[model samples]
Target: MKMTTHQPEHYNNLQKLCRICGERRNKGRPYHSQTFETQIKEVFGVDISDDRTDVHPKYLCFNCQSQISEPSNKVKEIIPVEWKGHDDDDDCLVCDIKAVVRPESFAVPEKPAPKRRKSEIKITVVKKEAAMKLKELNEHIVCSICSGYIVDATTVTECLHSFCKSCLVKHLQTRQTCPQCKILIHETAPMQYIGTDTKLQDVINKLVPGLMESEIKRRNDFYANRGLSVPLNGNSSRPITPNTQDSEPAKFPPDDGRTWFHTNDLKMSLCIEPVKKELSIPQMPMKFIRCSMKLKVEHLTKYIKQKTLISDEIELTCNKKTLANDVTLENVWLETWKRKEAPMTLFYNKKK
Candidate 1:
């Protein structure tokens, strides 16, 4: 006996069929007994039974619905079977398929690369205090004449007290006593007593910065104020030139031009005598020239050597006594030849 399969009224007029397998249940076969919508709703939790509205319904065949309900082997690999115990039905079969295809979502979200902490650093400083006080410095480097810090420092031989070179020179131009102790430095030529204290100068340079340059500037300013030419060294005192307008009355009347001359400008006769006959004269033995009070005995020996063509091996004597070269001609005249108006004779003796 042949039996006819009963088809639903909805399947007879359906234009759409199962979305997964594209199959319809219109054929008179027993395998097409169930509607595709019912199978899809049971497996994937989607209802496609109603067809009254404009929205199209999606359907899945019984075979495709059965395959979707079971988790895929790929999905099982990423999510363990034990995870089913905690399964929530809200996640649909479409969501399970996405998780199977893209497995990165299930991986333990790479525990956000351990937060790096910066190391704390500390710095230490050590401060040192000055060892000496400002007031205590005065006892060591104070100058007597300026009563300040000594610059271009000089020391007196007679009395051991220090002063600035310029200050001492200016003071000694009029006075012959030490500025600090008032002790006699020299009876005459007070400048001869002052000497440069190199040790003290070095100490001052170390103690005070920029002192030497400032001293040179001050000496330059002193000469600039006086309208005089500054010395090249800037250490020595300026030479004093005699002013004829400020001179005292002449010792003799104006008619005597020879007597009207200053004592320093007076002409004196120098007679050079050679002890040995072998030495020839460079010029005349007797020379009459203007004499300066500042001319020393050494200058006369030099002049005699030039005139008499004698070498430095010759020694000179005045009044049978060996003349000290440092003694000035004016000093020798006052001591020995003040009464003699004739040419002052210098006898030369050859050194053996």
Candidate 2:
């Protein structure tokens, strides 16, 4: 942002108009000696006319001049030049040799522009387990007795050991003992599918695309390796059910204490009948029929051999008939009913 008077020759004009002498001059062509005095005054900033005339009178003037801080001997040995107009061919006004003035502005040092270092941006990621409620299994893990497999099975005992459905059934069929710990178990004891009606099943269903196939198979394989029966590919056991008696009709608790059955109106089916008309063409012997049918028929013929004693050719009347007439259709009936099954309870409450 700094501006420089890089034109040193022009700077001489500025330096000549120092705050010392209070008069304005035309700065036209002055005498050589007077011009040298002016140049010296401009450089030294003071009038110096009293002594020492031969140090090239141009360089000797001094009046209120500041001490030359620069070593005088070190002045660059370049020849002084004559003053000239903007013409390039003119010679120097002093030495009269083809003159060149080294611009002081060129000597002014330049500073390098500042740089911006790029910084790395880091992203931090923290892994946290999703918050989820534990869904109760509709079935037990494996048979408690032999640590064997069960299919579509869930088992829970007072000891909290679960068993596979088939395995538990088999164990109950035999000695009714926990396969794992040899504890006595009862058939009536609470032994329904344990985990169900929980959000975890929905999460599992969402996470695993083929839930019943892949996830269930994986779990079954794990149980099977532990001597447990795996559920079959087709059917699995239902979720938790409260125990109930088969002879007693199942009762549903009421809406506002009384349950009611609702019915839905059935959708009706539609049937369409077709009509026909005909017109004869003046240019041709053929007749065309315009009918409600979406298709156009050029001609229709039927051949029938009736009970004729002898062969004979017969012609039928040319009246058009519609086959869709006199049609009978019955209204379809559809019904759906809800049948309540007795709830099966996990805790039959009978001690083994």
Candidate 3:
């Protein structure tokens, strides 16, 4: 009785078929960059996936690769190369069968030992397409206080939530908690804890087209109207010291209406700037004002009204909170003012 031997499957795919167009790879290039694969699909209008129905041939013959690489108009002449190559070892042309081979002469070849493979990391490419609206990204870019796109973006140190610098400053005058997260920005002084969020502000500027230009114009107009120089820094809301000789005030009128400080009175140097559209005496917008600390809040108000000559009532605030008519500047200095520095800064808006 004659015995037929079975060979192991390792004999398969020692030479792979081309992955792009199924052809027996002889002088073909191995699959290298995914870019070529993408080009093949885009130019040829043929997905490489169909050719890769089986695992054997993950390479590309030079002919097909060259065809895919050439410009589309020029490449239309050659490709869609019909290479329906076979994968089975039996189909190998090297083992050609002569007519009437003797069974006894046929011997199974010894399988070579498998080589050790080095560890490798495989990377994959993922592509997803979707649509998103500008409003959806409010948490990252919009100010919770203004309910608008953030300008001069500022971030709270305590909770890390961000808002427009002016809006947050305005809100922080009355509230101690973060507008978005309700986290305690500061138990005492929130402004001290917050700083410019440069990166976030940059991103916000990019996302909103023409927003930066509009803001620049608005700020320039505010400074122009108030007879104050707009700060070169993007933080335009902060108070600036008046430029003068002998510490004389810049925005106020001549010494006639300026406060007469008593010899013993504790004077507080104040930087009173305006918010958007905040009107001053037109002639005397408050850039730098000198007042006695012992005076009541009403005295300061009357002093400003008398000096500016504006008949309409005006409102003043430090840290965005309004001052009471009866409270003294000394109390505001000792208690309400947060900065431990020379000038006590304040912001004012039209009485609303």
Candidate 4:
């Protein structure tokens, strides 16, 4: 015998209820498997399966089914970074280093501190004070040659001699030697007159001690030189030109004592110069004088050659530093004899 199929009267009703809950229908998608966690998603919202397995087996959508299971352990928990408050006094948990917990009594930082100014320093500077004392302690000395007080600071003469303007002028007029070193005072013009002032004091303070000693020695040597030894009264008068013979006159021929010379004599006899054989002088070839410029050039060239052939005549003491002013002219003449001769062409070239 064949058996007949049986249909439950509530089948359609159960299907309609499943559609409302968004569960998968047997005719459509399959149901979620029996996993430890699951999510059931519905058009309305998600449904969750509790940790308890005793709950009834229920149809669920994929989204709602996933929500039902215990929340995914894969997702990480996010906590915000929390800054500790000043009052909280909580230690940092991450870094091992300790941060100072400033106290409430501490004052807030204001503007940065100002730098110290050296000029404003109130400390007593011994060196500067000593310098000041030195300046005051120094006494002004009179120049022996000029009889003038040495007041000018920059006006120290070559011999370490110093003097007032009028006195120096008189000294130069009368003497050429230094009042200090006895070395020849070559300079008529003093170094430069500068009375002691702030600027001058600074300069003096900066000068080395040894240089001052040298300066003094130079001046002493100058005053001791022979030229400065002329009598004071004699110095008052005009300086005397140097003479070869103090009292004698130059020699020349007397008028009437010479032997007779005929009128035909090529040389004439005068009272000053008696008849003598005519000297044969070198005569240049007879050439027409051209431009005056050319003649001058030739003369200048010869002069330069003579000058170059001679050397300086002035002599100084071995250790002496300066040339004496009065003796300088004589010294020049002395050196002229040894000077290396220069070509006349040099002078002519210089003119061009």
Candidate 5:
């Protein structure tokens, strides 16, 4: 009989067929025919049906009955996920979601014994003395760049390696890679990736008492004698303008005597810099220009094309990541390039 949704569950569950196979008898009474198994054994005085026959039927094992049987084996719906706009008529969608199963665990489980009683833990408090030797973390206390005790500790964001702030910054001006791991700090200005490790510095200072104070005093004396503003995290506290340069001015070549154009409008101005040893065809007529923050990458491409008589497409990049033509320069400056320093630097190359 075909089952329907409206069928009474009790009526559907009841079966009065063969005890062995739960099927109807097909042959003559217990002797000449059978519905499923047809084996028969005759005892001393009487005839006996073999196992699985109508007379001597064997029930299914527990596992087989649970798996092969119907409703009793169905997983109960303990958690119903509401599909706001789902249209698919599949009933098994609930099983696909991760960590959403609520399987009934009927098997007995062995529990782990607690190491300490909750009452004992809550009531007890012990005084413990802890001491750490400097030699244990000797390398951690020393600056990887200087190979000395860390002074004004700073950490590289990419590799999470700590070093002397001055050593890391000065190293970055020449090379933009981590000294310890050689990971790229940044494509443009690697100095920005360096962060002051205040906690690490504090730990170092405590480990070697008076080191931080002595360093700060020595730094103050040196700067005072030189008649310069005190330094801030290895950099000059005085804000650098276009006309002036950092302490190490002789290292970088001059920007062709280019200076920031004085303007009332607070729009962003950038230095269209070609990388070192790059072709001079890319060198624009004006190295500096005051433009609206809303300038798109396509505008920059067109501008570059006008300056250089070339048919090849130009590609703009910040931190070595290509810029989409539609993205505004301000978005790139704020989100991608992240060159907060005045005269934001952007690198470009011909799309090969």
Candidate 6:
């Protein structure tokens, strides 16, 4: 007979097993003809045609295909299976397809958290607008006398001008007018017209941070430069206790009632010369009186103004020389009145 031997069943039915899950099925079954490259392209939306010639056609069942296709939740679960013949290949078709398709599904090891410190320094940034406002406000607090930030600030009541206390004291030693406004602060005693403006000082302290401490240092430096002790209360009028052991005792007693003289270390007995009718002083000559040698010529001028009710538009002279307001009694005594007597004579003339 023509039909003799039956072909082998193995040759008749070509059965294939899944390379990934090892699922076996006959040729006509659902996934028997499925390939790793085709399945990757269909399921994972990955095209592996360029690398398909280099890779053998790997078979996969429906379940294994779905596992790799929808690996969003199973990325960590799916261990990369190595190819049987390729020892160097750690990645399987499922993992390769997943990496090509949804790379974000892989679990990247989380970075370790940064170490925290116990103390964290915080920086404060001031805005340009706020800084500008502070700068603008600072101009008002500056002293007109020294053109510096006011320290131990004093104000002229007549013109309402502010200055540092030392600056104003030094200014008034020569001038009776305000440094800023040129207004007459006092005809005779400008120092008496000025008072401590604590309100302004407090305002400055609030406006300028660290200003009070710096001002204290400046005042201390001033005292140090003059070889004088810094006053505890910062009042110039406050008497500094002298070192009695180092200083010689005063020849005369302290003039406790006198407000003009600072100390009575040296004394001079003055004789008032008889004034002419045209002169702006007393018509009759006055008696001799002891005075502090530290007194300025201006102090004598003020005294004459009080006693004789003469106008300030008058000048004092000794030996035909007009006495400067800054001239001290000791200097005048040494220069002009030394050879006269224990009681020296002084003359006054009207200012032309």
The model with the greatest lDDT is: 3
lDDT score, residue 288, model 6?
A: 62
Q: Give, for candidate 6, the lowest lDDT window spanning 10 residues.
A: 1-10
lDDT of each: 0.54, 0.31, 0.60, 0.31, 0.56, 0.58
Across 1-352, the per-residue lDDT of candidate 2 in tens digits comes to 1222323443343333222221112234322334445544555444546522211122211321222323254344322232333234333221221232434312324788676555554568999997743233222322344543333334344455554445555554334456666666553322222322234334444543464455355665554444433322322232323352212212222124533443211112222111122121011122222112111111111111122111333222111222221221110011111111211001101011
Off by over 4 Å in 4: 1-131, 134-157, 186-352
TM-score list, all predictions: 0.34, 0.20, 0.35, 0.19, 0.33, 0.32
TM-score of 1: 0.34
Q: Give the runs in model 6 whose Cα sits over 4 Å from its true position.
A: 1-132, 222-228, 233-352
lDDT by residue for model 1 (1-352), tens: 1112322322331233334333432323323213555544554454445442122224433445445556352232221111111123333222232333224422333567765555544456878987986558876698866778897678898877888877987786567799888999876656656778989889888888887767656655666566444533232234434553313222212334433224312234555565445535344455455466567878877777777666746566777777778987655655655436656766776555
Predicted structure 6, TM vs. truth: 0.32
Query: Compared to the true structure, candidate 5 yields what TM-score?
Result: 0.33
The C-alpha stretches of model 3 lying farther than 4 A from their native spots are: 1-129, 225-228, 233-352
lDDT (10s digit) by residue, model 3, range 1-352: 1111212221244234344444445553465424576877776675655543222344566656767666643634534434332344334221231211222222334799776555554567797888888888877887778888988788899888888877887787667898888888766545567778889888888788898878777766666566555543322344444553323213311234756333333346787665554444353465687666667887777766676676777777877679987987766765778545758876555576
Clashes of each: 0, 46, 1, 54, 1, 0
Q: What is the lDDT of residue 98 in candidate 2?
A: 23
Candidate 5's C-alpha runs over 4 A off are 1-127, 229-352
Error of 3 at 194 (Å): 1.5
User: Candidate 3: deviation at residue 244, Å?
Assistant: 16
- Prediction RMSDs, each to the true structure: 23.4, 28.2, 21.4, 30.4, 27.2, 18.5
| Model 5 agreement with the true structure over 1-352: per-residue lDDT tens digits | 2333323431322221223223333333332223222221111111224322212323322322322234355453222122111124322212222222322221224798769976677655797988878888878999877788898788888989999877976786557799999888887646556788899988898899888667766766666566554533233346434555444322111245755343321256777866444564457778776576667889988887888665788888787788899987767776785546767777777787
Tens-place lDDT per residue, model 6, 1-352, is 1221222322221223344433342234454224556656554454545433123234455565666667565533433222221124333332243432234433344999887675765668987753357667656798876777888678888878888877987787567788887888866445557778899999888888898777656666666556555543332322224653313222122234633434413356787653465643464346566677678988887777667776656677877778899998767776666445667777766677
lDDT of 1 at 93: 20
TM-score of 4: 0.19
lDDT of 2 at 136: 35
